[model samples]
Target: MEQNLPVACVDLFCGAGGLTHGLLKKGIQVKAGVDVDPACRFAYEANNGGAVFLDRDVESLTAEDLASYFPRGSYSLLAGCAPCQPFSTYAKGKDTTQDAKWKLLRSFGDLVRKVQPDLVTMENVPQLPKHAIFNEFLEAFDGYHTWFEVVECKDYGIPQRRRRLVFLASKLGAISLIPPTHEKHISVADVIRDLPEIKAGETYPNDPLHASASLTEINLKRIRQSNPGGSWQDWDEDLIAECHRRDSGKSFRSVYGRMRWEDVAPTMTTLCYGFGNGRFGHPEQDRAISLREAALFQTFPKTYQFIPKNERANFTVIGRLIGNAVPVRLGEVIAMSIADHLKMVNKAEKKAN
Candidate 1:
């Protein structure tokens, strides 16, 4: 735990390198990131200058494969934010335990036991801690000090009202997330208001990612009539979809709503760029939030290179990456906590000696 000692990290399930980018920013040397998605390679490598991206699934990854990346004797940290779709609230009442992703945490635990790194951390949906698989993951750290909490992303400067369960463990000593950075939550206007506007279905010529999805004629009118922070209930009776008129659909009031300019956006889901998903409609525009805007809400920098220069933005691919990624600011808070913990351990050791 010496102050000058080297600290290295390997990020598993590192989609688009959001966590890796944050760690690198806080001076943690991330040697590599591993993920099953080959599409993430370009973005990961492009954004994180010194990190290598391994396109492999965690199920097939072994400790030996990770060891090959870091030099011997360096203080190792293993970080994994395994896919949380199966454990998300969206999957409520569904039999998700049998899904292939439900076993990923087990694979992560196995790798942790095998590698036995100095530190470990993970972030996932709040629902994860309620699952049996989560308890099993904790059991893997029987001999280590662990700390975890369901944290509000807005408290960490992310311009979205996303709540995620974060866990940190160390063989070295106790560690926890950094205290909230912002007393006031950042709002949608704070993050995306400055970007140049584009009409529905039109891609911004200068930035392909800023392109908005095309809206149907009816959907366009619906959005035009949609009030910021108001649900479909505020729309004209004619604008209400037929399904919403049914008794079962009365509760689905969150759809076709516009985000409040002064309030943090609702959680960005895989379909966040779609006008009908959640309250993703733009506060002032007659369109849904664009791909670039969604990335911004996730705390990715405007300059974060997600797609290649010549490649046009693909909504399905980019939306998944942006929505599924850990907010960059949240990752930085975790990294800062780890760095502070190391510094504290170093100080204590020096005094003891």
Candidate 2:
């Protein structure tokens, strides 16, 4: 709130601090992070330095609670990115009315109204705009200059090809996101090609950072059958399940797929290890992705610290955290754009005064 201090951010659903890390690089001071997973506490705090990471669900947030962190109008930012599962492609056609995640967006809007910060932003699947709750959010947030667009993570120089819808709102005036940073899209090889190779059930010998999930026999066979940038259609017809043969299964592609060494990776997901999940197999390796590979794709620093050890990197909860995180590089772009906007606002105010 002080003119001398930098703009501050309170990140909601801040998984592993990926967005916080990027915003920090752009000179935004992160006040704290909120999330439900206790597993993220260690890495989010350790890697993010001064920022406090809260392991609380967003639905439980209150004005009094948020006001305690931020005095009246002291908070320059009130950013909230509710989890995207309710509207994600994976949940397509599934009834989500009873789902608790549906309320997260409107609750975020409620927080924005209560906190009354100068700026706010949210990130989620593009399909979110189709939901009624999202429509209510837009209606409740009138008068703030707002823009929403589906952006590709690769366009912002992240080494993965992922798409997300981003929302930026500011009371100061209209604010738009930065355009793509890298004209030449970064490739998977550019990020992780140098990491040492490990077998199906192995970890790298020299680099403690190197890690992979152990594979079952069925998974190994599935990976061998998969082709980079290809789909389950590559599998032998015998390997196809009765479900695939059924009328409802024809549209589900991307299963047991691999990456292309020359291109950015497919979107990372919570079930990235499952052969049937998506195009998550290694580009050249004879296995599904390892923990180290997944983190690399998410653009997390190699030196980031998590509790326990790298051997446990592929555990369900840990893997989910890494795969679901905002790419640090993409986060940086958003941060820089916000910082630039802040500077412009300050300059205009000085001239007017």
Candidate 3:
């Protein structure tokens, strides 16, 4: 655990390398990131510099497969932020337990048991801890000291109000996430107000990812009428959707709203680039946020590359990568906490000796 001792990490379910980027920023040596999405290879390797990306599913990954990338005798950290859609509140009433994705957490736990890494960490939707698989994952940490909390990403300097369940376990000793870095939350204007403007369906000539989703005439009109921080209620009665006229639809108010400049943006979901999904409309623009803006809200750097120079940007593929990513800032906080935990344990051992 000493500063001189080597610490290496292998990120499982490493979509687009958000967590890996954060760990590397904090000086942790991340050897590789593993995931099934071939689309992520470019972004993951391109932005993370030296980290390798293994395009494979976690279910098929063996202890040996992971061991091949890690150094022998180095303190190893196994980190996985398994897909959260199965356990998300939005998926309620569906048979989540029967879903194939439900087994992913168990697979992650099994690998931890086999690899027996010095540390383990996971991030997921805040509702994840209520599921039985979560408890099963904790059981895998039998001898390790573990701590978990539903953390607000804004408190950690992320410019979005994303609430996530974060778990950290250490064989060395007790561990927790780093303390909040910002007493004042970062706002939407703080992150994306400076980007060049583009019309719906137009890509900035200089930045490929800055392209906005094309809006239909009706949608464009809707967006123009939408007020920042206001719900569907702010729309003209004639412009309101047919669904909103029903008694049942009155309760669903967050959709088709614009983000407020002074407030933190809502959680970015996989479809965040579309105005109809959540409150994704741009505060001043007449279109939904661009892909680049969505990634920025997820705390990815402005320069994080999601596509090759010659390749055209694909909204679905890139949006999923950005939305599913663990906010890079949150990942940094986790890495710093692990580093401090190791330092504390090392100091205690030196005193005891």
Candidate 4:
């Protein structure tokens, strides 16, 4: 490969272009984003710098299909974050290996073997390292120098306490992630405090995504009684659910809780917009965090488009995209790691020549 050639990337399973956006912010040219969900196309293409959004399953793609996305003779990077529901802690140890989503990782490995991109990266739930399938995925990097670590998103400057496995492999030489960027931590207040506050079920006139899900009257009472950094236990006894009265429910106290302004937030999930789901209640507002708040916690730009114009914002659809996305800040850090690795490789080659 020649020096000064562009490094073009193709992101598989690119949900809402979080990773691609981060890479673009760090000066990497992502040529395309491929995912099975057609809903992702609008946001992926609209926010990214002309990166084509291919609405196709990863399993159905051929090496030729992906290779065509890169410019001729340019360095190729294949990046993806396969659907992690099966490997997620939320799966609760059920034999999910038979789940179709489980095979997506293997499909990712298959493409690596066929396309043999000069660089590769993947991000997933941290528990994946314990699975046998992860070992199988690592086999695809036999000739490449590989590095992976379970990183705390808060340490990477993400305002949420998300932990993920970050993997990097390079045919050029050894590679690793850059050190954590934030030491004091980014508080929940740091990210969303300035946004205009709206009541439950109200949408900010300026942004449709800023809408919050409506709460039942009882739930509204529960949220009003709730304290930041406190669980449902802080609520009046009348507001307690039947499940919480049981011994089994004592351990599930994180739900129906308010976020503490001084601390990072819990991991944003597909249902994060609902106050009943997790620690999703706004610190000061009398409602659950809005969909826009969730996206901001994921480090997406305030102007990042989620629902297209003239389209209604469905909480379920948009929440899933925001929650599942790789935090944009983490993506920038990954891009920086790759940039540093390539610079080292180029200098070594120059000296050898």
lDDT of 2 by residue, 75-194 (tens): 377775687554334454555545675777767887877767778888888787766667678875777898889998888888877888889888887789988788898888887788
lDDT of 4: 0.90
Candidate 2: stretches off by over 4 Å: 1-5, 71-75, 88-100, 205-209, 309-311
User: What C-alpha lDDT do the candidate models reach, one value each?
Assistant: 0.88, 0.76, 0.88, 0.90
Choose the strongest candidate by lDDT: 4
Error of 3 at 222 (Å): 0.8
- The positional error of residue 252 in candidate 3, measured at the CA in angstroms, is 1.2
**Regions of candidate 1 where Cα sits further than 4 Å from its true position:** 87-100
Please provide TM-scores, in order, for all candidate models, with all chains considered together: 0.95, 0.89, 0.95, 0.96
Q: What would the per-residue lDDT of candidate 3 be over residues 60-168, giving only the tens digit for each residue?
A: 8888888876797678999979875544344554445555667778889999999899999999878887666677778899899999999988988999878888999
- The residue-level lDDT of candidate 4 at 194 comes to 96
Tens digits of per-residue lDDT, candidate 1, 275-344, equal: 8988999999899999999999988889998898968999999998988888888778888999889998
Per-prediction CA RMSD (Å) = 2.1, 3.1, 2.0, 2.2
Candidate 4 local lDDT, 1-353, one digit each (tens): 22466789999999999999999898788999999988798889999978999998888999999767877877789998988654334455455545566789989999999999999999998888877678888998879999999999899889988889999999999999999989989999899999998999999988999999999999999999999989999988988999999999989989999999999999999999999999999999999999999999999999999978766699989998998898999989999998888888889988999
Model 1 vs. true fold: TM? 0.95
The window of 10 residues in a row where model 4 has the poorest summed lDDT is 86-95
